[model samples]
Target: MSKSKKSEFRPNDYVVYPAHGVGQIVSIEKQEVVGIELELFVISFEKDKMTLRVPTNKATEIGMRGLSSPDVISKAMTTLKGKAKVKRAMWSRRAQEYEQKINSGDLIAIAEVVRDLHRTDDQREQSYSERQLYEAALERLTREVAAVNGADEVAAAKQVGDVLISRAAAA
Candidate 1:
C-alpha cells in the first residue's frame, strides 16, 4: 500500500476540478501502481453523478481548487452587471471563446459568457449554440456559487439569474 500525503483538502470539502465543476472530496486514498505510490483525492460530482481521482501533488497544476472566495464571487456578480460586450465575429469563433472561458475555471470569465449571451426584451432570441454555451457557463457558475454560499444549485442559479435580469432590465 502507498503512504498518504497530508492535503489541504479533507473529506466533505467542496472543490472545483476544471473539466468538471463543483465536487466534494469524498476521501483520500493511497494506491500503488507498478510499485510507485500515489496519493489521490477522490471527488464526487453529484450533478454529474461521477467520481474523479486526482493525484494530490498534481492538483494545483491541473487547476483543481477550493471554492471561490466571497470577494471573487462579488467580482463575478459585478461582471454580470456590466454591459455585454458582443463581438462582431462569427458564431463559431464566439462559441469557441465562450467554451474556453467556461473551462478556464475563472469566475469572472464565466460570468462574462453569461452576461453576453443573456437575452432581454427587444433583443433577438439566442441561437441553439448560444443557448448551449450560456447554459453551460451558467451551470458552472452556479455550482461554484452554491458551493461557496452553502446553497443548492437552484437557489444559486436564481441568485445569478436575478443579477442578470436586473442588469438587463436597466439596459
Candidate 2:
C-alpha cells in the first residue's frame, strides 16, 4: 500500500546508523536490483566521506534511527557526570567491549565508553589502544551532541569535557 511505502525520514533529516555515526538523508531513490525494484534511502556521512543506501523498509531493522530526543540527550549528559565503571577484565577484553559500545550507536552507551576510558592529566597515560577507543567514542558522542544541540563539534566536545572534568573534581 502507498501508506506502507512511505518513509519516516525526509531528505536533509539527520539520522544515526549503527556502526556509523550521524548522517543526513540525502535522497530516496528507486533502483532496480537484479530483477526487482527497491526503494532506498541514500544517506551521506560528510565527516567520513561516505554514502550508504539502505532499503526503506529495512532501515528500522538495521537499527537506523532519528537523532536522540532532548530528554535522551539530557540523560546522556547526566551519564557523563556519573562515576566511571571499569571492569577488572583484561585490557584486551575491555577494549573489545568498548569498541562494541561505540559502534552500537547508542548515545548513552557511547558516553559510558568515554567516561570509562577518560583519564585526567594526573592519571597515568593510556595505552595506545585505550587512547584510540576513547577518541573514537568521544568523537561519536561529540558528533551526535553537536547535531542535536545545533552547535559545532568543538563546542560539543568542550561541553562533554566540562562535564567529565566537573565529575572528576567532585570525586
| Top-scoring candidate (TM-score) | 2
Clash counts for the predictions, in order: 0, 0
lDDT at 91 for candidate 2?
Answer: 93
- Scored by CA lDDT, what does every candidate get? 0.90, 0.92
lDDT of 2: 0.92
Clashing pairs in 2: none
lDDT minimum window of 10 residues, candidate 1: 1-10
- TM values, all candidates: 0.93, 0.95
- For residue 43, model 2's alpha carbon misses the true position, in angstroms, by 0.7
Question: Could you tell me how far off, in angstroms, the CA of residue 8 lies in candidate 2 after the best superposition?
Answer: 1.4
Which stretches of model 1 miss by more than 4 angstroms? 1-6
